[model samples]
Target: MFFIMTISNRKKQYIETVEKNITKITQYTIFNRTFRHNDRKFHKFLVEPDLNVLVVGIGNGDLLASLNPAVGVGIDISQKMVEFAAKKYQSLNFIHHDIDNKIDILKHPIVGKQKFDVVILSDQIGLCDDIQKTFENIQALCHSNTRLIISYYTKHWEWLLKLAEAVGLKVKQPEQNLLSTTDIEKIAELSGFEVIRKEYRQFIPFPLLGLDIVFNKFFGTLPGFRRLCLRTYVVARPHQTHEKKPYSATVVIPCRNEKGNIESAIKRLPQFCDNIEIIYVEGHSKDGTWEEVLRVKEAYPDLNIKAFQQTGKGKADAVHLAFSKATGDVFMILDADLTVPPEQLPKFYQVISSGQGDFVNGTRLIYPMEDQAMRFLNFLANKTFSWLFSYLLSQRFTDTLCGTKVFLGSDYKRIMKQREFFGDFDPFGDFELIFGASKLNMKVVEVPIRYQARSYGETQISRFRHGVILLRMVVHAYKKLKFSV
Candidate 1:
């Protein structure tokens, strides 16, 4: 009973200490302001605007207000901090509750039955006595689509942070949980959350005459240097149980000069789902591919096949045209060259339909390819670009140039809406989808497919020419994704 009372008293003291220092901790010093601004910028990048956002441990409510959430709710342990935030940010809802000890936060009258699209726990997980329990408690306020962002300072910066606090450069507070990124990941898993991605930011906590921007954006983002970053974030979602459903699939085959493979493409593709629609967008093929498409459609009258002559040039244009006409729930891309066999498309369909992944990409590099499937120079280029792109996109991509990519029609529409952001620069059509998926924070999953040598068509890829284009796209992505403010 004595030990129990001591624990209860310690909790009360922690709350009181935080409540008393609310105003002081949030004071707008130049250094404090810079840190907060950088943090807000990073959070804004991770979270899309116009979302229903719930900010746990919202101190002074500045971060929540900056996000401009559609429905913003801020919760904190200290009543004084909550009251202060409520008075300042009248537009957003604020609640005072102990996340570690209290009942479901959703049980509060103000937030009843409201599920958030994004749940932010910025630097708040450290304040919880039981981080796992805190995560479990917050799950009540989330839906399957909700994205939970947890940010905290890395332990490597503890000494520097303490020195700053001692010298009055930053706010000093009670002892925190101070768990490592691995510890936090494990705790989140225990609390029924699956981590999507991890990001490290803010190598220099204070702005030092614009060097902060240069170092943080370029030098700090390097693979080795990122480990020493002051701040780390883990993006997660509620662990979901996916069951296969009867989702209709639209297989869009963008053919350029594949007359020999047109009929074979139709015959080999199995009926993977109940309602399958095959769209063939012939891109001005010199080998009579368009004529073959027409003949195949006439011959296979029972199959739901639609053929169209592409009005524009390049594979990207043809793909965009077919995607616009796609009628099924899911959209699939199968290159008419027949390098990635049409038979393996079922694996792609199952992944997307079963909710195993949001953006399913075929990886030809995983399985042993046929001897003549890929040229030596092209194979080396693919390997190099795969690693480079995976780093740039924050997702594992084994084969970036794979023609067999699958995603939902709804997601493809969302990508189309934001096409202006990246511009219609990609002629090959792969980077557009890849970049769009990364921008939308979609889970990119790769499926290994046996790459077969083309039986009829020659490889259209010009190593030197397309290699330059890929390099240009990499530069553009760095500017938009990593280097951008």
Candidate 2:
């Protein structure tokens, strides 16, 4: 039919256009140099050494090689580009195909039928004829835990880019789709993907040494400044199906001079799983908190309880010791003061067991707190730290100081293995788990909980002293997580 022929002709024309522009751009060194720099920036966020990566627009194969994924697969519409990539990087598999069209991705022998851990669309979404269909096609290559990373230029930079092209600093290209961050998000939603985080970066594309570091690393992450950045990135994943199986849990209570609340905590904690293991890591309490823990363990003979006296000084050390002794599929941290209710533990457990998120953090900022639950200055500090950490980690977190955090036992072990990177700096054990979960590319979900006034002895935290410690950790995280890559 004529309609079928017209559709075939359009496909041929689109492919020809892409191939011609791609082949032409190969001759420009300045253009390629700029792209190489952009590739490195994307590499820092998308690629981890242990992941399996599938890059949709693998132009020169530099991005794929930079990632160093265990299993790397690259695909492109241009046969010339595919040939160049295949010959240059003999280790990685390069295929000549149009991602806009639906194809059996499992047909490839090298990639096999297994789903990839990360699926990347590196500045190529703009060239697709049907962006939603393009995203839908790649669903076959993803698992529930897979992260889809998309990077593209903001429309605000369109004029500047054209000027660069006019001056021969950049390569000329055919007109492509110009999509804003919100537009791309909507397309992704229609394609069965949910956006987890959105970030803007690269205020200065040219390397200017100290100036570059200050602008991109420090000032670029700021609120109003980040909106003007050249590049925008969205991290998304497939909508997961909830699992209906029961899981065991371990609630770790790192108590340090909370003798009055020990028995109350044990009694009020709800049983949500097949088995609930309670671990008490009593720090060098000036009060008789360790003795109280031992007494409670003997009195509550029906409950699964274990107690340990921490040899180390800080709460982080106590948690590290307790986690080592924990025996459960789900690991959790509950403050002994009972600020966040023990009954809320079931909500955290349900989130992880249902495949909702890998790291579930409790947020106290959403609900109204009890009278005198937190000091005015302390509340202000929590708000300030939340914004700083959300920017630092590229994930939205409202209450970073909340002590109730939960994750799988397997993930906790992996985090402990990489703890040397951050060192023994976190006294509260909050940032250790948060930064670890972010580094592993895990889904982080925040659950709102009521904050109650402490019924025990005086608070152990020194407001000014711990505040200084938190600021130091932020700078340390900036160096290790933001700039190190």
For all candidates in order, the CA lDDT equals: 0.84, 0.82
What tens digits encode model 2's per-residue C-alpha lDDT throughout 308-384? 99888888888889999999999999999898999899999999999889899999999888999999989999999
| Candidate 2 total steric clashes | 0
Q: After superposing candidate 1, which stretches have Cα over 4 Å from the reference?
A: 1-11
Model 2 lDDT, residue 237, Cα: 90
Per-residue lDDT tens digits for candidate 1, residues 1-485, read 00121234545776777766777776777787777888899888887778899898787788999899999988776677788888899999987666564354546776657889898897877767778878988888888768899999998888898898899776666677777889888999999998878888888878799988888898778788888888898888887778787899999999889999999998999989989999999987888888999999999999999999988998898998999898999999999899999999999988887777889999989888898889889899999999999888878888999989999998898777567777877888899899988777787889999999989978888889999999999998888777874
Best by TM-score: 1
Worst 10 residues of 1 by lDDT: 1-10
User: Judged by lDDT against the true structure, how good is candidate 2?
Assistant: 0.82
**Residue 410 error for model 2, in Å?**
2.1
TM-score of each: 0.95, 0.91
Q: Give RMSD to native, each candidate.
A: 3.0, 3.4
